[model samples]
Target: MNSTTVSPVAEVGMLSARERSDHTAFVDGGFLYVWGGHHSVAGEEVFFPSDEIWVYDMSSGVWTIYAMGGEIPPTLSQTCGCCVNGVLYIFGGCAENGHTNQLYCVDLLDGMFTWRNVTDSTGTPPSPRDKHSCWVYADRLIYFGGYGCKQMREVTDSRRFITDEMSWVTIGTMLFRFWGWNNEVHVFDPRTNTWSEPQMHGIPPKPRAAHSSATLGRMGYVCGGVEAPSMNIHCLDLETWTWTEIVPTSTVPVERSWHTLTPLSDSTLFLFGGLSMSGETLSDGWIFDVHRKEWRELQHSHRDKPRLWHSACLGQDSDVIVFGGSRDYALLADTISVLQSPSQSHCSDLLLFDTQPLPLLRLCEDCIGRNARTLEQQLSWLPKKIQEKLRKRILFFRTAKSQGTYNSR
Candidate 1:
């Protein structure tokens, strides 16, 4: 077995390194969490600090580390991330010494790394950039405008990562360019592996990085990030490809960057701590309901100092786990936290309600919904009998649901 260590704080509620390690890009298939900044061990400087990826596991409630491949790159702030088919991809950021156009991919299932030469690509990847906005769709990884290295100005370069072809393609350029800003959203079509130019039809507040975007159903929402004086929430419709400016009705989070946004089952997005304009980091949290278009301040609090550039992930049972980053202006080595999902009075209200209660002779709707594709992919993982059983069950659910009798149960 790989060398694994447990945390000293064995409290059932707290997270451990084992759990956090699962958040690293390309860990646990295609699951992704935020990556907090790196710090050193006791009395020792952090090795390859800039190249290290820190992840938090909601299951174990701990922080874990994974070393980046090749020589460690310089320390970078405000990089961008996305996941495609279980691979974690990171793109352009400003290192301590300079800006970078490097693109790296890590496989979560096997813990392997592959670095791509973006500069050498025939399509010409974006110039060395920092503080960009990025996302993944289908199999394409798309990155938008960011601050350029030489000009030190925001640019409109659009680059893509195509997994099947294992190549980088520069799509059409952005309509506008601005850096040190937030509120830009881009979507890619994996089928075509190309990007649509920045949609100007919507009332997108303004272009900004350090903001967060989460997709619920077909709609995506962007919320709070540094925009100078204060932060605000905004929504985008993936279907219409338009923006809806939202005036957060409840106590909202402070404006900041390098924070996290995670999607919950009920179409709610959680916002965690980030760096404030005054250079102060935050530990406070908030939740935004996309369906209702509202925000609610979280009452619970943590003992750890406020931090920025930390990572967060949703785990089984609706628990949210946070991992390492800087606290009180210094990098942190070992810190982890887990926040349980708010209690629900009805079992049917649990996120798993639709997926549970494995069918006996019949197939459970939940099983078919969640595991059907996974089972098909790993047919060899199960015995022939089990595979047959699952197939039978799926057929039953499809027939029942189609007949409209499944809901009667």
Candidate 2:
């Protein structure tokens, strides 16, 4: 975690000349790295793909633009990226002429930052495609559905359903109506440079493109994407190679695509903006507790811009940083916003309280109770329902007690 004190109050800042959309970002070494998105000029209908790399400092709140060494990757959009160890792996995306199958990486370890185009001579690589999903589990990289040449789709134009009441059709058979979807599962082991198409068990997710995948424990969870935006969630057990459908206990997210399903430290996936099937950009955000199988919409109001094709990266101290995406009329936003969690706000309160004067600390000692050696220990005494509330309120006022010392200056 970054040691610098970050305020609990949420902040939104616009980056100059950093406006883009359809980009990919990941956190490595407490810093956020962004790469390969497209930006549109005012009064222009076309989006120019970017090959530049942008780094955001979590502690100092600064952005660094780096001219990467080695063979620079082609300008692309809708790519997938994940951090393995200290290396950032960038996979296939839509290029200028078309989609690509190239895999590139930038080494951040040993302070020798350089790009390397890894050769895949061991086995056949997956088809060249974009709008797919990739996740790093242990030492393997799992790749899933995308717009590609593979004949993984279930149905053709010949299949038709007369009514919604047709219960005889299996899900795999019925989902074939939506073309350009892939149910194939591909795994790449970086250690041996091998690719394996695992014969997965149980019912696989309906083929769809542009979905999000993340690792939780030994399971890989996938959620909502284009062609099927009904908030259907599925998890693949990495151990058993089986798929289990997870139904949320709340109202499902609207049918949408291009949104982010980011895993947070609190065992919840923070879902952000995307585009609905009606071509309407959505600004709503929700948090889904994977363990409890519940969804709760974030009610604290901030800047609400309906966006699609944006990238979201979870930052230090429970801050979900959102950057670059398209709004209505293809207007590209250059803004960066941090969605602050309550735990983060509480964290700030704890920071402020810890720096108070001795007399002030003594005054609040009684209210804090005994044997409360640490914040966690103190919080342990409170009931589950109101523990967080009491923790925040107590910590906030502890700093308020020391305000007069600075105010006098």
TM-score of each: 0.58, 0.69
Writing each residue's lDDT as its tens digit, candidate 2 over 1-409 gives 2222322122221222256666777787767776766554444324433334566554334455554567557776667778788777777876776668788877655443457777754777777767888867887888877654333353332211011222223224544332244656788777787778787888877766667777767788788775456686788988778989888888887877777877775467878777676656777888788888888887533324555676777654555766666664221121011122222100000011111133654345435522234554657765875565455445433433442211110
TM-score of 2: 0.69
lDDT of 1 by residue, 1-409 (tens): 1213322223212222321111223134222234433334443323234445544332222334555555334455556666776556666776665567676555444444333333333333555655565544435555544434333244333222111111112111432322233233444443453434455456655544455556566555565443322456665555566667777666666677657676666578777777676656677777787657677776543523464555555543444545544443422211011111132010000011111233443344345433666556775587888676566555534443443312221
Q: Please report the candidate that would top TM-score against the real structure.
A: 2
**How far off is residue 188 in model 2, in Å?**
1.6
lDDT of 1: 0.47
Candidate No. with top lDDT: 2
Model 2 whole-model lDDT (C-alpha atoms): 0.59
Give residue 310's error in model 1 in angstroms: 1.1
Report how far off residue 117 is in candidate 1 (Å).
Answer: 3.7
